[model samples]
Target chain A: AQTVTQSQPEMSVQEAETVTLSCTYDTSESDYYLFWYKQPPSRQMILVIRQEAYKQQNATENRFSVNFQKAAKSFSLKISDSQLGDAAMYFCAYPNQGGKLIFGQGTELSVKP
Target chain B: SQTIHQWPATLVQPVGSPLSLECTVEGTSNPNLYWYRQAAGRGLQLLFYSVGIGQISSEVPQNLSASRPQDRQFILSSKKLLLSDSGFYLCAWSVRGRRNYGYTFGSGTRLTVV
Candidate 1:
């Protein structure tokens, strides 16, 4: 069984600043995928970024990036230049052998001006 | 372009009432379909998944059941609703062999069982 953990229940980042949301997981598979998703007030789940286990280099998507430490089973998301629109509930996800997504308790982010 | 549709947006039912939620995918064939339940302040719980028509897999042991009558259509149902079943239900679709492409989710349906 694969499980993802998001330690922070909530996070606050100032407008135009940066913030990092922590995530960790337990998995035995050597090859898999990790993902971060955002849920806005409209309740739409949007994919933020993805990282492949085989890739040593972390993945970056514009302002959203991931600090993936495979050895420690840590995959954290970093949001740069946080904006008001970035205020949402962020989820860290792991993939199961059946290709099902296992999500962690979401971290609610608030962008303060 | 592929799209997944799920409805209705909100449902309010009483205890022991029946439940019927539908999900359909467009612009794709034999896509992997999934149904998830999201409780307030909790993570998404995968309830059911289907690889093709007439094949459904359940992740959790619950009162809910799922069906895939068509390659692109998935349905979730229950004989009677429980207060614990009240939550936001989400439907998602993805390419069968390319899970790395991630999943495309529907707008989600909020169900409240009183």
Candidate 2:
């Protein structure tokens, strides 16, 4: 069974600053995908970014990026130029080959305007 | 350009009452559907997933059940609701062999069992 762990339960960042949320997972599969999802006050889960295990190059989307270290089983998300809308519950997820999406406990992100 | 829809943004039901939550997708076919639940201050829990019409896989054992009556439609139900069942229910869709495309999620349903 694969398990994603987000050590930080809550995090805060000043608007326009950067924040990084840590994530680690336990998986034996050589091929897999990692994802970061953000759930806002509206309660909608939105995909932030994704990294394929085979790709050593991190993935970047707008202000969101991921630092994926396959050997260390670590996948962290970095948000730059953070905005107030960035405040939310951020989750790290991994989907098994069977198509089951496993998630980390989640980190609540608070932004100071 | 696919979209997912999950309804009854909020629901309040008494204990032991029957429960039903519906999810539907548009602009896609033969997509994979999933049901997830999020308890307060917790991670998302995958409840059920369907690869095709009538083919549903449950990830957890509980009082709830799921059905896929149509290719893009999935339903979660319980004959008798339990207080533990109270949580935020989310529906999502992904391409058959390319979940890398990311899960397009619904707005979610907040279910409260009294």
TM-scores of all predicted structures: 0.97, 0.96
Model 1 chain A — which ten-residue stretch has the worst lDDT?
Answer: A93-102
Global lDDT scores for all candidate models: 0.94, 0.93
What lDDT tens digits, residue by residue, belong to model 2 across residues B1-114? 788999989999999999999999999999999999999977888999999989989888999999999898999999999999999999999888885887889999999999
lDDT of 2 by residue, A17-80 (tens): 9999999999999988999999999989998899999988999999999889899999999999
Displacement of residue A68 (Cα, Å) in model 1 is: 0.9
Query: What C-alpha lDDT does candidate 1 achieve relative to the native structure?
Result: 0.94
Q: Which prediction has the highest lDDT against the true structure?
A: 1
DockQ of each: 0.71, 0.77
By DockQ thresholds, what CAPRI class is model 1?
medium
Model 2 scores a TM of: 0.96
Candidate 1: lDDT of B49? 91
Docking class of predicted structure 2: medium
lDDT of 1 by residue, A52-113 (tens): 99999999999999999999999999999999999999999986778798899999999999
